[model samples]
Target: MKRIGVFICWCGSNIAGTVDIDKVAAAAGTMNGVVYVDQNKYTCSEIGQAMIKDAIKEYKLDRVVIAACSPRMHENTFRKTVESAGLNPYYLEIANIREQCSWVHKDKEAGTAKAISLIRTAVAKAAMNEALFAVEMPITRRALVIGGGIAGIQAALDIADTGFEVDLVEREPSLGGRMAQLDKTFPTLDCSACILTPKMVDVAQHEKIRLFTYAEVEKVEGYLGNFTVTIRHRARSVDLQKCTGCGECLAKCPAKVASEFEEGLVQRRAIYTPFPQAVPNKPAIDRAHCRFFTTGKCKVCQKVCPADAIDYEMEDRLLTNGYGAIVVATGFDTHKLNDYGEYAYGKHPDVLTSLEFERLLNASGPTGGKILRPSDGKAPKTVAFIQCVGSRDKAKGNSYCAKICCMYTAKHAILLSEKVPGSKAFVFYIDVRTAGKDYEEFYTRAYEECGASYIKGNVSKVFPEGEKLLVRGVDVLSGALVELLVDMVVLAVSVDARADAKELAKKLAVTVNEHKFFTEAHPKLRPVDTQTAGIFLAGVCQGPKDIPETVAQASAAAVKVAAIFSKQSLLSNPTVAEVEQKLCSGDMSCMAVCPYGAISEQVVEERRGREMVTRKIARVNVALCQGCGACTVACRPGAINLKGFTNQQILAEVDAICL
Candidate 1:
């Protein structure tokens, strides 16, 4: 018989005042195989630890049961103490008398009885305990950054500077992402490309960085420390090695499509570059718009190119690379403003999305840096920006803050004043949220120094008036109806998850919240960590974040990856349950019910060797078992039981406690 010792902690009246500790200890002492039952003021304290060690030595205890706080709090402490005393740490268990019993229960009798039952359960489990250990895996020192936006660029540069190899991937013809589409960044009023393109070039030239543009991450598989990624190189239809990014083919292509890079304000050729300052100096062709793809008749791009760069036969190539760690900086897409019919977004020529406005204000944009109204090609005298267009609305199904709208809208207001000189600008917002460092000051400066009007309400509707947009809304603060006829209306749309976010998450088997963002291990403590081991999330893909916060979080994820690389082997808790095959019957009931996939059926022969077909009971995969004990209750034949928490040990403890 296994000798078990029960230690009930008073926890300085945290438990004893509500639970009768003596009654619990006395009941435990009379149990079969329970050699000793003792009560302590604090079981987790050093003195209380010494009492436990002394009792173990005296009673020759094979298992220990500490009736005190939740195991989440003190299980590790007691386990370490047992390990230090040259005993198997997994042979210890804790009864959560403090939080689960005494603190929650008011009555003395009920609390005491609950404490006794808890102690009995722990004693029962401890008697069947077995030791466990963690398995470490080698980490690759390289990292893969999945976006070319500000956040991804910042992360790539930081990790490269740390003497690590980084693979930077982008789905566009150019390196700069949505941030490049912006004319100016908020609050500080820095030119978006002026501040960002330099880093884009840095990434292109960095020896430690491998930059991939017009390429997409087709698939990501394997765990952290060893991840395999397949990248699809879209047919650029141009020989990148031969063409010097000379403007020859772009000038000759006959087919023209609306340039999405310019927010559909201008037309681009069939073979075109994203912008004048595109990194890698390469051009991509629009396969759908190219006449050659439709009829196989046009060789205009090839005939015009001085350097033989156009390859009609070029096929998409898939390249696979192994990465040690991955930072998912996939970024976000702005909600299509056309959904809000009240805004008259697509119906009116004057109404534009915020991105279109950004293009209009850009020097390299369709209007050549002039903020012209689309209908009349005239400078706007007054412009209205609608904030939270599709954010913070349950009906729209986006209930969380988009986070960057308030600041960007304020910046748009400031820019409109600078662009038109004397033009009036209005920002309609449900709530002005500026929750970042120095962010509030920026919003305040826009109001006080920029001379923009900030209205506290949402815009109800918009109607066209020949060349202008008539905006109607109520100012909630003043309780007054407000109407404004503006030359242009900018919709500060919400940031939604990328279309492939859910699909990618499913492939990785990671959990995503309702917003379709990857769920973190914890909100505050483990922000960069995902529910899966070795994988980390960064930038707007996890949630909407500005440059500063995204960089900080990206750097944090890099640090975590670096730390994992520094370790020789990974360590994990070994206190997981195991099954005794000799006692197990061929019942498949527990196998079907286990949530962790820890239990599985295996073929085994009985002692009689009758060659009979048996159900072959479930066995726990120790490494994956989280030790939730769900399998123990699912066993109809009493075959499945947790190694450290068995039926015999518990029933003996209960019998002794009642006596």
Candidate 2:
């Protein structure tokens, strides 16, 4: 029989003010294997800890129960004290009396009775405890970064700079990603390529970074500290070592396709680079649009290239790599604003998205930085910027603020005024969300200093008339109806989930919120982490964020990876389940009821190498198991038993406490 000691805490008016702590301790003292019972003013206090440890030595107790606060508060502290007194740490149990009993109940007798029941339960639980230890496993010190956008690039660079190798996988042909498509970063007005292309070149040239453009993540398996990732390297149809990027093949190629890098604003040849300053300085042949793929007659790019880099026969290959950690910086896609009929998104030529405006104002864009209306190629005198088109609307099922719209929209208004001098720019927002440092001041400067008109209202409708958009809205604060005949309408749409974020989360067995963003372990403490260990989340894929927030999270994820690598190997919790195959009747009763999928089938073989048939046997993956003991109760054959909290230990403690 296991010797049990029960200690109840009054918690200093927390429990005793409501329940009778003395009677509770008396009831616990009468319980069957319990050799001692006492009430402490505060069980979690230093004096109480000393008394408990001294009593353990005095009574030669094997198990201890504390009826006090929640286990989340002081379970570890008491367990450490027990270990110091030569007792197994797992033999300790905490009964939540203060919150779950005394504080919630109005009747003192009922609360005390409830506290007694809880203490009895803890003694019953602690009597069955067994010693357990953590198992250690080695970890590989490498990382895999999904997506080649700013977030992914920043994470890869941070991890690589910390002396760890990084495999950067980008689905696009170029490394710049969505940042390469932008004209300038908001509020700063700095050239996007000037700041971003340098990082691209650095990634391409870094010894620790293995850049794989035009690649996609096919599979990811294993847990933290040891992950096996399979990446599909799509055939670029051009050899990097041989291609000179001299534009000779691009000039001669006859086939043309829409330039996805420009968001279909311009056209490019079948064999061409994504942009002028593409990293690796190579051109890829678009097999879908190439004439040779359709008719097998034209090899214009191959024949024209002096270096002969084009290879039509190149096929997709799967490459497997091992890494210790993973950063999911999949980024976000813009919400399609065509759903709302209030804005003529696709129907009117003068109404455009913020991305389209970025191209129109870019120096390398189609019009060479000319702010011309798409309808007639004429610069407009008045432009209206609409905010919250697809965000914060219950009809669209997106209720969260996008977090970056205000700052960027203010920047757009200022830049548009600069692009077309003497032009008037009006911004309509549901509310100006400038929550960042110096962000509210920036918004104030846009209105007070730059003379940009800012109004608090939602544009109810937009219609086209003679190459102009008629925007109508009423300012609720000013109590005035306003209508503007603007030459162009730029909708500041909200940032949404990446097109493949849901599919990727499903593949990784990670949870995503209703907004289609990846869910973090905790909103505050573990912001850059996913619930799955070793798999960290960074940037807008987790939520709507600005560039600064994305970079910060990327660095945070790198810190987590570095910490994981600092350990020689990870330790597994020993409080896991164990199965006895001999007692199992092969009826598969425990296998069907177990939620953790710990049970499986095993074949028993004879000594003469004869098959003994397959039987449903239970096995536990100890590292993933939490040792809840539900399987032990469900097993009809009594084959399943938890290691640390065994059935024998629990019943012994229960009998002692109930005596």
Candidate 3:
């Protein structure tokens, strides 16, 4: 019989107060195949680990069962302990007594019984365990960064600095994301573009970075250390090689469409660049609005182009490349105000979203930095800023703070007072959340120094009054209803996940929470990492975050990519599914159920009597299999089974537990 050692941890009062540790250890020593049993106050501690290593050497134990906390917490720790003791890591099995038995049960008798059963099951599994080794795969040494926003730019720049090739893909024509459209950032009030534009230029000039503007990541295949990515290069109808960033085409084009860069505050020519300091500075023809595409007659851009760069017949091209890692920094979108019709957003021309107000405050915007009312081109003397429009409201389907709204609203009030002399700025907020560096002081300055009125209340409604808009709300602090006539009303709308976030999450096989924000591997420990290895998350795509946090996350993701590239090869998980060729029925049932596409058909030569015959059987690719064990249950003839969690091993455990 195989020799097994059982280690039971009291876990202080966590397990000992509820379950009898001595009785459980004594019971385990009598179990079949178990040669040694030891109890410890903390088995994961250094002293307990030394005891385990000494016992293994003394008892000549080949398999070990640790009845302790949940495997998620210390499975890897114990696995390493076994490996250090000259034993295979896979030979170790963990019984969750702390969480499953001790913590869950109130009665000591019931807890002791469950703990013994758990330990027995673990010992049974340990007895049937076999040694397995990891498969080494080659690394690609290249990285792909999605989104051209500040996060992606920073990640790309950092990875490129490590002497590895990086492909920076953007859906927009420019490199700057939402930050480019903002007037100024919070607290410090530093110009957004002043800091962001230089990085955009750095990404453009970086020798190791390839800028893929007006592109999207179409498909991603392969596993960690090696991935094949297909990027769809959308037709810009303008050749980057031949075109010089001249204003000839823009000046001559007849088509005028709403500008996305300006948040639809002004009109832009069909043949236009996003902004003056665009990375490439080249213009892309908007095929939807361009007269050449809409009607065969108008080719004003083509005719006016001095370089003859416009290509109306240009087709979208697909470029496939390889990468070692991918960093997703898709960013976020402002919550649409459809549900907040009570604010009269679309109905009233003077009522604006925070984003719209940001564009208005920008010096390059339609009114040339003047905060003018949309209904009438006049500057607003009184501006009302409303906070938490679609945020922290269960009725609107969002119950989380937008995080940046409170600070940005404070920023708006401060800027309003500075830009317009004697302008009255009134802010209505449920709560002022200024919990960042120097943020509270900035909010205090807005009220104390900038002469802005801070009202603790929720805006009830905003309707048209004679010449100005009337904002009605109750001052919660004063316990009085207040109505003020304001020239312009700005709603601090909620920040939400991008519209296509869920679709992209499905494509990448990454998990997104109920808020549609991409879920990280671990919220605190693995903030930059996604559940999928070799893929990382950055910026607001993971959750609502400020620019500082976004940049830090981007750099962290870049460091992860650099670390992967630093390694020549990666070790594949040994717990992946394995196929027994002798038991194969030539059925593809295992292939049908595999979520990661790890199983495939392979031809094998089999001896039938005295002759050899070729037959098809399911083959498992260990690199792709995440050791989920779904293929194990799907096989009818039992040809496929996970290496660490084998059929015999699991059955042995079931038998022991039932007995």
- Badly placed stretches (over 4 Å) of model 1 are 5-30, 35-61, 65-74, 77-81, 84-87, 94-121, 239-243, 304-307, 477-479, 575-659
List the candidate numbers ranked by TM-score, top first.
2, 3, 1
Name the candidate that leads on lDDT.
Answer: 3
TM-score of each: 0.82, 0.83, 0.82
lDDT of all predictions, in order shown?
A: 0.82, 0.83, 0.91
Model 2 worst lDDT window (10 residues): 605-614
In Å, residue 404's CA in model 1 sits off its true spot by: 2.3
Q: How big is the positional error of residue 625 in model 1, measured in Å on the Cα after superposition?
A: 5.9
lDDT of 3: 0.91
> Candidate 1, 462: how far from true, in Å?
2.2
| lDDT string, candidate 2, 1-659, tens digits | 88999988889999898788878878888776899987889888899999899999999899999999998989889989899998888878888998899889989888888888888888877766767776786798999999888888899998999889999998877787777878877666689989999999899989999999888999877767777888999999998788877889988989999887766677998887888878766788888888998778899888888987888889999999998999999888888775777888888888888878888888988889899988889998899999987889878736888888788888777788788988888999888888887778877877876778987898999998766889999887899998999999998888889877778886665778988899997899989988777889988999998888888998889888888887878887677777787786666676666544445567664233464555555566665455677878888767788886677767765674475
**Model 1: per-residue Cα lDDT at residue 620:** 71
* CA lDDT for candidate 2: 0.83
79: Cα error in model 1, Å? 3.2
- Name the lDDT value of residue 492 in candidate 2: 85
lDDT of 3 by residue, 211-296 (tens): 99999988888777888989999999999999998879998999999999988888899989998888889999899999888887
